[model samples]
Target chain A: MDKSTQGRLEAAVEALIFASDVPVAASRIVAVIGEVMAEPAPDADAITQAVESLNARYDAQGHVLRIRHWAGGYRMTTTAEMAPLLEVFLRRERRRKLTLPLMETLAILCYRQPASRPDVSHVRGVDADYALRKLLDIGLVDVVGRSEAVGRPLLYGTTQRFLEEFGLPDLDALPNLRGIEELLSDPSFSQEKARLFMLQGLSGATEAEQP
Target chain B: MYRVKLRDFDGPLDLLLFLIQREELDIFDIPIARITDEYLTHVRRMEAVDLDGVADFLLLAAYLISIKVRMLLPKPAPEASDQETEDPRLALVERLLEYRRYKEAAERLATIQELRAALYTRGSASAPARAEPQEVLINASVYHLIRALRRVLTEAPEAPALVIRARDCTVEQQQQFVIKALTVGRDLEFSRLIRGRNRIFVITTFLAILELIQRGLVVLVSTAFDDDFVLALGASGG
Candidate 1:
């Protein structure tokens, strides 16, 4: 690649990582930078190196920035040394400690919103009355409307803050857990099966998925 | 011997179920007079019960009182010809019976939550010191049970000994220290970040790096062909 073309690729990658609120995965960085620069960076290693060089330069210059891997992907961030800047940049306030059950309930509502409390309970293998009420109290889940079935159950949905906490933009952006929709519809997927589905779906494969 | 807040009670149905459990009464053949009296007493003791939730409890109460009233009136002018020989309480009896099943189911669900929680503590013990518990949590609907379990988790009578071999260091405390250091330094090297740290400290530092990156406070950049990833944060962090 020509010197100017390589320079353009570096600038584009820098912009993408900087603009991202969460880690920008290496593959994602490669795709976005490659498209913008319109030059073949060939091989994953080539892209990886360019990204690393940029990181070195930034560190040498003491630019309150860094990229670290989390949740199986790389992301950009302001160093902990400069975490105080968040006093101003934190638009979505952090919550009180999120207990495990609270987080799971939030996940169900987030992934299967426009869903009923009973429906959520079904998938979780428990009565969700208390959990649903808790979500309501926190304002993270709301009674969006009613379900289509009899009893016209009050349906629940996740708020935007729920998405922000996971650094997800929308429901569709959430990593898939296979058979989730079917499990909600039937509420009988055993805990073992659900766990396996999440592990599998996380690998970006949808094969052998049972409804 | 204990009083639970209305918020802690879940719902009126939940309160009613709690009373049943507390009294050890058979739900299939409820002692209507005793239960009705006790339920009203609890309601009088607390004023914040939701109106709609109360209405639901009251509707069932009304049905029970009516059944007793009808059972009291003799022969009702030959029963007005439409009433069946069956006890009027059958319908309500069926409702209480049905509702009890769901209550039992909810309780069973709570047990599952507790079991799941125990599993987490076990997993935490086996994991690398730096590994925090996974982010996937038990749902909030079952959080009450989790609360109960957390109470149990802390019940392990012995406190861990505080040793300075980095054994005294907790992940939370370390996360904060690393974040503070990075924030003040503006930028730091991967090796520089781990200086004079122990193995456990190294793991936590790595996790801190991951957490910071996840939060968008760290950025990793590279040249066209380098394996050495230089970690950077915003202009104020390294």
Candidate 2:
């Protein structure tokens, strides 16, 4: 490809990541690029160079988002400089923060876990698929395995981050439900979940937590 | 007891909404029995598989059974002064509905992040770029698509009923597999290579991936859904 085409390709890749609300892997980017481009784009190296160049361009100077490699994908996110405006996107007023639902569902899972989605719905009296997805995206809950019963069900459990966020020493340290009242009062429970999760990450929890 | 991961979450309301929506029932009027069945189906599916994605969904199951029982059983009539008997789900459901609205707003705001990235070229244009979301609207509407996926999953081939036994898949094997495919075919879709393979092989596949990542021979990525990681042959080793 000519230099201009290559540059356009790079710009397109940057634009896609910028537009993505969440992180996506480079393979997804390559697939989208190939679909749009008439000729096969120059290899992934060129794409990587293009992304790196764009990242450097945004980082060296001031830019809205710097390309971040996250969750095994490339995504565009706001910089700390622009966090206030993004907070506006968060919209605290008149909004039932995610804390309530997330906490409610999380409480159900942590306590009555190895249960089913229906079991959770029965207890919480609402569908939890969305929360489940959000939880998955955040790296909080995970599938433990199938039930041994005639009708097996997926079991849910808390990660080390769950302990870290709650300021618990470990899963064993998870306090009993007696603190529900206190937990219900703290609206930041979900936000805290997100905060500690982002800080610690899904995989490197303890090492990152220790810091 | 492996830890649960929650990265795919939209919000808490999304979870409640999913429950309400699962039975293809109204959010206001819940068909407890059917809802329970569908809910359990999701749970059972999780129990059947060992993927991390199903963990939280399972824990919520028991709580669901409890609410169903409470709603089903006739309670002693509260005295005139007694607080009105609540629909056990009332508090939690309301919270879900409310959170759902904010979550939508968050999604909108999140999309703006995407537009800002795509439309603007920092320093090049004094003014910000306009957003482009024409085809973007064509996303799997989280609500409808999930139910549809659940329905389709019923028919998806039973991967295997026989061997739940864990295997010791070595990374060396996956590296060889990636190399094997690349050597055989010039190019391959990532999904095609990963599917129909043994579980033990996945570890090896991942090992091969990391090895290639280090050697600069192969690249792994997902095309659309984060469901599968696609591998593309890079030029370094080739």
Candidate 3:
């Protein structure tokens, strides 16, 4: 393609991603650009190349925004460096750290998609009803379908919102499940445990005064 | 009285994992006797605070003690061809290992979430329109409020008997009571609202709060304590 044609395609891709509130799929972008240009639709590869070129230009020029491929689509998001100022402007609350229960319940559903309440509960050794409901409220997990077990319980799975929120292109992008030995050896593990113990100590001191 | 905070530990397995990690014990060869003793201490602490899910911890405590007993019991004589005896701790160890894998996965997810929080998308330039005006309470579901109510109910003193009283405490009256109380102070701790009240009064007030929340007259905000929540004036409230 000529330089002007490539520039037009890049500009079109940039416009679509910038205007879209949700991520714009490559096919939708191709169709839109193809109809506007009155030519054969550009393939996914062309769109990908356009995105790469646009991102490259943005990076070379030190632009704050970048096109990110998330949840099977392209989205224009501000670079991480601008987050602090953006957060202040947005008045965003400190992101609600997922409580331990919700995190555990989410991890279980993430790995074992379409799992029932009983399945999660069996693994965690506690009723997962509360955590599951909280996750649903957070838009991370959703009822995908029903199980084929005795009572046919509702099966839950991670939602598209989950993928987007985690910045994962797909479930395949999930970090590898580290083995127990590796997790044990991780220095962060001990640090987290120590922090939890300190929290426990503070709370335990308060509890001693009660009754 | 080391009250086991439900938020800190997800469940019984989580508590067990904590004990093991604290001691740096080998997961494969957990010393059941020592771990069981430490586990019971934490369980007792949970009971002392009347935590929401102490029963789950207690159940695991029972299993741990049983394992300790089995370890103490004598083994059968070795056959001509020695058979490998199954360790009583084997099942528990496997369960712990499984739980650990997911726990680690959860941490990784948390990290991913943190990184994702930094990137601002189109609609995320401003705070997303929320159902509740309070951002903290956006994640606090009705179930969480109900759990807090459960704690209050358990702690409430029983009603006095032998008094044939009229059914004067209706939902509307309690609703007015809540609204009026909040009008005095913009925020009210739920437990404080029902403190020194009878069972009927407490139950009626709880129902009133639920109704107010449904109508967007009040919002339930989570406090530092899991068993307690704060009620604030909603967007439409007086």
What's the lDDT for candidate 1? 0.56
For candidate 1, write residues A102-123 as lDDT tens digits: 5556655655678897777654
CAPRI-wise, candidate 2 is incorrect
Error of 2 at B34 (Å): 2.0
Candidate 2 residue-wise lDDT, A1-211, digit = tens = 6888878888888888766654556778788888887867457677678888897888888777666554455656556466455435443222112344566667666665666676666554456776676665555678777777667867676664444333333444434333222322345235454344334322233233121
Which is superior by TM-score, 2 or 3?
Answer: 3
Off by over 4 Å in 1: A1-15, A21-31, A41-112, A116-156, A159-161, A166-211, B1-8, B13-37, B47-53, B56-238
DockQ of each: 0.01, 0.02, 0.31
Q: What's the true lDDT of residue A68 in model 3?
A: 91
Question: TM-score ranking from best to worst?
Answer: 3, 1, 2
Give the per-residue lDDT digits (tens) of candidate 2, residues B1-238: 3222322333323454676754455444466567767767655654454345555565556666787888888865887434446556654444444344334433433333333333211222332222311111233333454576688988878778687666676777678778889778756666677778776676577667778878978865445656665567777766
Residue A25 accuracy (lDDT) in model 2? 62
- Report the lDDT tens digits of candidate 3 across residue range A1-211: 8888888888889999999988889999998988888556789999999999999999999999899999999988999998889878888776777767778899988888889999999889999997898788878899999999999999999999899989888898998776544544567456554344335332343243222
Score chain B of each candidate by TM-score.
0.36, 0.43, 0.50
Docking class of 1: incorrect
TM-score of the candidate numbered 1?
Answer: 0.32
